[model samples]
Target: MIEIALGALITLCLLLTGTCLWLLTNQREHARWQVERDARDALRDQRIKELSKRLDAYLTGSVRMGEELQELRRIVAPLPDKLNQMEQRDPSSLSFTQAARLVGMGASVEDLTQSCGLTQAEAELVSKLHQAQRRKS
Candidate 1:
């Protein structure tokens, strides 16, 4: 009976030691897993913050681009009217070819200047040059 009791006490101690080791190992694994999960969560949150900042920057750029485009449109709005006015001024000055023809017909320099809107010196030059050409021909 004494030998049997001693054997039972040793067996119980071995079982208790095994259980304690298993619980300790399980607790360490749980701690490691918790740390990894926290790291992953922190990384995900950081990425989300960066993405939000980028989106805000893109939105701001889009709004600025839209405003610049509107300003450009406003600045250019009167260009067509100004172009039409310039086009309509065609009747102000007679064509250079017409002035040359008139010079060939013996029109005076003053007449060429007034009718063709040429400067006095330009009219004189054209008259002299064309008269010389006519004499040669």
Candidate 2:
């Protein structure tokens, strides 16, 4: 009877030891998984921050471009009015040849012709005259 009781006690101790080792290994695995999850979350947050910064820079550049375009428009907005006043004061004052030269100076042919009510032939004559002037210069 004594031997049988001792054997039972030893078997119980072995079972308890195995259970403890299993629980310890499970806890370690759980800790490792938690660490990996935290690392992934951190990496994801860093990527999000980088993308947001890039988006802000792009938006800033676009705003700057828009502002520059507006400035250019403002600078050129009074040119048509000045041309119209000049046209009203002198229809024939600027000869077709002179008008052509003005066209060559970056004035649109349509705008120059319309403002002066010039025929295509007259516009061409002005262009030829401007070309001659350019050659002289």
Candidate 3:
């Protein structure tokens, strides 16, 4: 009877030891997994912040471009009227080519051509007129 009781006690001790070791290993693994998950979440948050900053910069640039475009339009708005007045006063005396030349000396040829409907020959004439006028001035 004494030997039998001692063997049962030894077996119970071994089972308890195995259970404790298993529990400790499982706890360590759980901690490692949690650490990995936290790191991934932090990296994702940082990426989101970077993207948000870039989007803000893009929006700011778009707004600045819009303002610059509006300002350019405002600066050029009076030119057509001035050109028309000049033409009205000297229709027979000034040719389209001469007008185009004058416009080219100070303004964009594309803008002048579109506004005044001047042909390429007229644009060249206008450029020549502008040179002559500058010389006189």
Candidate 4:
């Protein structure tokens, strides 16, 4: 009876030790998995913040471009009327404008002087100006 009691006690102790070891290993694995999950989440959050900043920059640039375009529109709105007023104010200047157009069409200085009634110096100046304009274009 004494030997049987001792054997049962030893068997119970071994079972308890095995259970404790298994529980400890499982807990360690759980901790490691939790740490990895947290790291992934942190990396994901950082990436999201970077993307948000880029989006904000794009939005700001778009708004600024829109404002600049609006300003350009306002400045150009009265240009046609102003040009007509200048043409009406000086009817003879129309001859010079036509002379420049002819020069752009590859006309010679003598042609401008004859067709547009420009002086030789005026025709030469118009030809030079249109040639310079063409080169710049």
Task: Kindly list the per-residue Cα lDDT of model 2 for residues 17-73, writing each as its tens digit.
Answer: 999999999999999999999999999999999999999999999999999999999
Q: Write the per-residue lDDT of candidate 4 for residues 26-117, one digit (tens) a residue.
A: 99999999999999999999999999999999999999999999999999999989977886886654567778878878899888877878
Best by TM-score: 4
- TM-score of predicted model 4? 0.59
Clashing pairs in 1: none
Error of 1 at 59 (Å): 1.0
User: lDDT of all the models against the reference?
Assistant: 0.91, 0.82, 0.79, 0.90
Cα deviation at 28, candidate 4, in Å, is 1.4
Candidate 1, residue 40: Cα displacement in angstroms equals: 2.4
TM-score of each: 0.55, 0.55, 0.55, 0.59
In candidate 3, what are the lDDT values of residues 6-40, reduced to their tens digit?
99999999999999999999999999999999999
Who wins the lDDT comparison? 1
Worst 10 residues of 4 by lDDT: 90-99
Per the 3 Å backbone cut-off, how many clashing residue pairs does candidate 1 have? 0
Once all C-alphas are superposed, what RMSD does model 1 give against the true structure? Answer: 11.9
Task: Give the true-structure RMSD of model 4.
Answer: 5.0
